[model samples]
Target: MLVRTFGWSFAITVAGLAFAGVLWGWQGLAVVAILSVLEISLSFDNAVINAGILRKLNAFWQKIFLTVGVLIAVFGMRLVFPVVIVAITAKIGPIEAVKVAVNDPDRYQHLVTSAHPAIAAFGGVFLLMIFLDFLFEDRDLHWLAWLERPLAKVGKLDTLSVIVALVALLVTATTVATSVPLQGGGTADKSATVLLAGVAGLVTYLVVGGVSGFFEGRLEEDGDEAAADADGAEETAPARRGGASALGLAGKAAFFMFLYLEVIDASFSFDGVIGAFAITNDIFMMALGLGIGAMYIRSLTVFLVRKGTLDDYVYLEHGAHYAIGALAVILLVTIKHEVNEVVTGLVGVVLILASFLSSVVRNRRLGEGSEQLEEQAEIPSGV
Candidate 1:
């Protein structure tokens, strides 16, 4: 399973490195290597979250994710995304943006960096909503009871996550600590633009999530009926899942899951596009490095889904969501403050590791308790 999951990933890695080596020889290769490491490190939590979603997708969608999805990750988000951003922000044609990126990478980097405030606002709010939505749900299993329980209570309010995200976006725009002057306008113009982009992100999340929920409801009703016919018994698990659930494979749920995965990738890419500047200003190199890293992350997601890693480490999802919340804050804060990519990446890594450790301890306790219960049962309760 591991080999099957990561086989193409290894191939992509080699191809990415070779692409870099051809572009700038050994120097480019080294930069791609470093960027790849940075991307994988920062995105490990993203992979975990993705695995939770991906396992719900069917075999066809799973194959689409590994194939078409990776192409989008590699070329779409890494290469074209920055150029598109620059083109929009700088009010230049796409051709001009591409030319500038290829011929004058430093200037391209400047344009991309200058647009970071808006980018951060969009990605930050989107990610924060994801984390908040997960926490706000009334789930039996609580990882951070002190906080999540209260959040769940508050979540009883309709569209609370959307409200909070809007408030956060407003606060971010207003309290950006020394307004950023626009290209040909005042700080107010830039702030308004940033707020609009942030709102766009919020809207995108709602539409996508709503679409997912719609399809989920449809599939769920069908699954419940199927389960009922099979045994005339209550659906033991969520109706959203299937028999291949142990494999994390979803039937029709794959479509929505794939859409969600792409949105999630776009959210992750905001930081990647920004962080690429710290390493190399070359757009092609950034794509090669970050794109390859994305492939690996996707591979990891598949591996985790296939191997039942999430089932084994139940609390891992909580940790990943928490890391996402932290990242959202970091992105919002970055509007005025320059944050280190290492710091950003390390925050996620620590949260995930901590959760993994907690899961390990919980697993051990559960195992021991089960053993004790079995022993007592064997001895006969009345005696």
Candidate 2:
């Protein structure tokens, strides 16, 4: 299963390196590989979160995620997005920016570095909203009527998320608008922009999310009666929903998975994208390096899902979410200043590892308790 799921990933990895080799010879391939590994390591939490979503997706959607989704991630987000950002913010002609990125690498790096405040602010605030929403929201899955009442109340409370998102958006807009006139030595303005950008990101999440939910609800309603009839015929059956089942929870899950994955990917890429300024400015190289890293992260997500790692380490999911929350805060705090990518990576790594170890300890104790209970049962109750 792992091989089938991730087979294309390895192909893409090799192909990406080969392309890098063509561009800058052996040294380029080495650099790309190192960067790719770094991204994969830093993004372990992302993979776990993605797995939670993947397990809920149908196979067809999963395939789409691996294929089309990857293209959007590697090319659209990592490559084109950065260049587009530089073009719009720097007032440089798009063509000139691309040319500068390709030919005059050093100058390109400077442009990207200069634009770091905006980029960090955009990614930082967007991720902050995501983390906050997940952490504070009441998310309890109930399977009974008694539970439904409380759950309904929680559902209504979703308005809080919307309200918070709106406020953040307003602040972000105000900051960006005011900061425009105060370029250079504009720490206050930059800080305002960062805060506003985070708000803008929250707004984007709410809007895009609402659209996705609307369509998903319509799809589910259409499929409901057919599913009910199908369920009646299979009393002794294993509750098989088959392909339709895939379309059910799985499809919805996949869509959200896509959203979450994209958000996390965007978060992790902020530093690499910003740090690329330290390398050559050639937008191509920047894109190439970042794209390579993205591919590996995607591949890692697939590997985790196919291998059932989440099932094995149930706490892994919790840990990743916690790490994402921490990273979001770090990004927000460092908006106007420099924060080492290594530090960012280390923080996430430590949080996730701690979570994993804790999960292991908890599971071990549970297993031992179960074993003792079984032994007691075998000996006879009264004895």
Candidate 3:
């Protein structure tokens, strides 16, 4: 399973290294290697969260995610999107941005870093919404029952997640974003930019989530109607719904879900892109390295879904979300203070590992209890 899933990742790694070596020698190769490791470590939780969403789509859409989705991830997000950001932030054309990235890498890096206040605000708010929504949701299982149970109860209030996220954005903007130092060595007031970016992020989440949810609800309604028809009820609407309408609804749901996943990936990549400058200012090398890591992450998502890993380890999703919450806070904090990528990566890795270990222990306990009950039942019958 490992080979089958990671074969392309390995292949890409080698090719990317070869390309980097040809262009910029051993130093380029080393930087790409470091960036790849950085991306994977930081995004392990993202793979878990993605698996939770990807499993809902059928086989065809899953294929689309692996194929078309990766292109959007690698080229669109890693390459073009960064260029676009630089263009807008630097007030240059796309062509000029590319030239700047190639010829004046230090300047390009400066431009990208200059835009970090807004980027952090947007990504932070979007990720915070994801974490908050998951935290407030009522689930059949809870990893942190003491905390989650209370949050779930409070979540019954409409738009609670939105309200909380907005408040967080406002506070962070007023405090942290306002204190971020400018290139000229004085603090820059970025409160308005942060607020605007944060609102854009929040609205994007709502619109994408709403569209996906609407289609998913439609699919569920169709399913319930089909089940009723199977149970010998009048097959009035379902009989008409199955052929084309059902397929259309499924397609729509998958498409929107795919969009949601891409946006999530983009949010996860924001810091990685900005942080890449610390290692290498060459944008193409950054793309090659991060792109390789992204392919592996996508493959990991596929492996989790196919192996039913989430089902086996129930708390994995909860841990991923908690890690996301941590990341959101980190992004907001970084608006005023510098954070090491190592710290970001380690926090996620630790959360995921802790949850995995907890799941194993829980499974062992459940097995032991079942065995005890079986032995007691047999003894009582004999006695």
Top TM-score hit: 3
For every candidate in turn, the CA RMSD to the true structure comes to 4.6, 5.6, 1.5
Q: For residue 342, what is the lDDT in candidate 2?
A: 79
lDDT of 2 by residue, 74-96 (tens): 78877777777668777988887
lDDT of each: 0.85, 0.65, 0.91
Judging by lDDT, tell me the better candidate of 1 and 3.
3
**How far off is residue 48 in model 1, in Å?**
1.0
Q: Runs in model 2 with CA error above 4 Å?
A: 18-22, 139-188, 214-225, 231-260
**Poorly placed runs, candidate 3 (over 4 Å):** 233-240, 380-382
How do the residues 137-204 of candidate 3 rate in per-residue lDDT, one tens digit apiece?
98889888999999999999979999999999999988888778877698888999999999999999
The deviation in Å at residue 194 for candidate 2 is 2.9
Quick one: RMSD of model 2?
5.6
Rank ordering of all candidates by lDDT, starting from the highest: 3, 1, 2
How close to the true structure is residue 261 of candidate 2, measured as C-alpha lDDT?
59
Q: Residue 90 in candidate 2 has what lDDT?
A: 75
Error of 3 at 63 (Å): 1.3
